[model samples]
Target: MTFSLATWNINSVRLREALVLKLLDQECPDVLCLQECKSPVDKMPLEAFAAAGYNHVVARGQKGYNGVAILSKIPMQEAGSHDFASLGHARHIAGKLENGATIHNFYVPAGGDVADRKVNEKFGQKLDYLTEMRDWFRDNRPEKSILVGDLNIAPREDDVWDHKKLLKVVSHTPIEVAHFAETQAAGGWVDVTRQDIPDGRLYSWWSYRAKDWDGADKGRRLDHIWASSDISQSAHSSRVLRSVRGWEKPSDHAPVFASFDL
Candidate 1:
């Protein structure tokens, strides 16, 4: 079976329901994973998504905060969810497709502006969350799985527009990147996006503060798609829909995509 998947941080699903529908209508990915939905599951506009031909969904959500959801045209069953670090946030959810490939969607905490955990509680939470993810993956050792989400940290130097300048910044900090690396190692995950486009500065998110976002081109690769070693070889044609960032009242993030021939 061949299928395509896309991961996006919709920011607020309710507010951007139209944009989501637009994506479904245009791109028509076989599956679409969304993060930061910021609405209760019952409140999510699932009917609209259903009408768009996404009949299967698995999600965990909270009011006005972190949330994750997977909408798929193909059939899928809810696998599970986790509250890493006991942060009490709706940040993770999983689903198993008929083809036996499991999909994990996550929205990792974006460490606060300050990178120091000693003085920043949010930063500490972010690190703790990543640590827990690493430990969990080490114990479980996932296979035939694909993980996608807004992981928040940019592990590679080329992932950020100005790596040297952002070294001390929260997302590109050494500590955070180390933690992210450990998690990937634990799961034996291959970065599908990087594997396809191996060389260059690639970004999935741009700051809203930029006056001329496209012209300045200051961005970060905060979102990711990872597959286990067992199925990584089947994943290809990875790309980021950068033009989506220019959509009307769009989320700061652009969708990351990949196809799998399993």
Candidate 2:
């Protein structure tokens, strides 16, 4: 079966519920993985989602904080949920599709303003989170899996608007990128997005602080979709829905999409 999938950091699922519905109506991906939902599962508008054809869901949620959920039109069951770094945040959840492919949706912490862990606890948590991710993948050795989310790190040089200027910035910092690469290497995951669109300044997140976000284009490719090497080749049609970022009361993030044949 071939199905299209999208990963988006909805910011606050309850706050942007309408936007989510709009996306479902417009894009209609078979599977949608959401991060930073910031709404407890019970409080989320699941009834509305089911009304739109995404009747299956696997999720881990917390009230007004980090949360992740996977909504699918296709049949799927809860695979597992992990608390990397023992942060106890609703940051990681997994679902197994009927085709036996596992899908992981993650929301890695965005290290705070200062990159130095010595000065920032959030930065330390970010590093520790990545470390745990690496260890988990190393042990699990995932196959026939696809991982996607707002990973919160831009590993490639072209992933940010100004590579050199953003080198000291949290998301593009060298240490963060190194940790991100280690985590990706651990799973032997293929970056489906980069594989399909190998060049150009690609970005799925733009700062709300930007007065002219589109014109300035000071964005970062913090969101990603990855497939395990075993099934990576079957992934295609990867793209970032940039226009969605301009939607009214939109989240800072735009959805990143890819289709897979399994």
Candidate 3:
């Protein structure tokens, strides 16, 4: 079976329901995983997504904060969810497709502006969350799984527009990058996006503060798509829909995509 999947951080699903529908209508990916939905599951406007032919959904949400949802054209059953670091946030959800491939959608905490955990509680929470993820994956050892979402960290130098300048920044900090690398290693997850586009300054998110985001081209590869080593070889054709960030009232994030022939 061949299928395509996309991951996006919609920021607020309720406010951008139209944009979500537009993506479904246009791109029509087999599976679409969203983070930062910022709405309760009951209020997610799932009916609209259903009408768009994505009748299957697995989600965990909160009132106006972190949330995740997977809308799939193919049938899938809810696998589970986790509250990493006991932060009490709706940040992770998983679903199992009929083809036996499990999909995990996550919205990792974006460590606050300050990178120091000693002074910044949010930064501490982010690191703790990543640590817990590493431990969980180490114990669970997932296989035939695809994990995707707004991980909120740019692990590589090329992932950020100015890596040297952002080294002290929250997302590109050494400590956070170490935690991210440990988690990837623990899970044995293959970065399907990087594997396809091996060389380039790829980015999935741009700061809203940028007056001319496109012209300035200051962005970060905050979102990611990863597959288990067992199925990584089947993943290909990865790309980021950069133009979506320019859509009317769009999210700061653009959708990242990968196709799989399983």
- Residues 1-262, candidate 2, lDDT per residue (tens digit)? 9999999999999999999999999999999999999999999999999999999999999999999999999999999999899998999999999999999999999989999999999999999999999999999999999999999999998999999999999999999999999999999999999999999999999999999999999999999999999999999999999999999999999999999999
Candidate 2 lands at a TM-score of 0.99
**Model 3 regions lying over 4 Å from their true place:** none
Report how far residue 183 has shifted in candidate 1, in Å.
0.2
For every candidate in turn, the CA RMSD to the true structure comes to 0.4, 0.5, 0.5
Off by over 4 Å in 2: none
Output the number of the lDDT-best candidate: 1
Give lDDT per model, in order: 0.98, 0.96, 0.97
Greater-lDDT candidate between 2 and 3: 3
For all predicted structures, in order, the TM-scores are: 0.99, 0.99, 0.99
TM-score of 1: 0.99
Clashing pairs in 2: none
Summarize candidate 1's per-residue lDDT along 1-262 as a digit string, tens digits: 9999999999999999999999999999999999999999999999999999999999999999999999999999999999999999999999999999999999999999999999999999999999999999999999999999999999999999999999999999999999999999999999999999999999999999998899999999999999999999999999999999999899999999999998
State residue 135's C-alpha deviation in candidate 3, in Å.
0.5
Arrange candidates by lDDT, highest first: which order?
Answer: 1, 3, 2
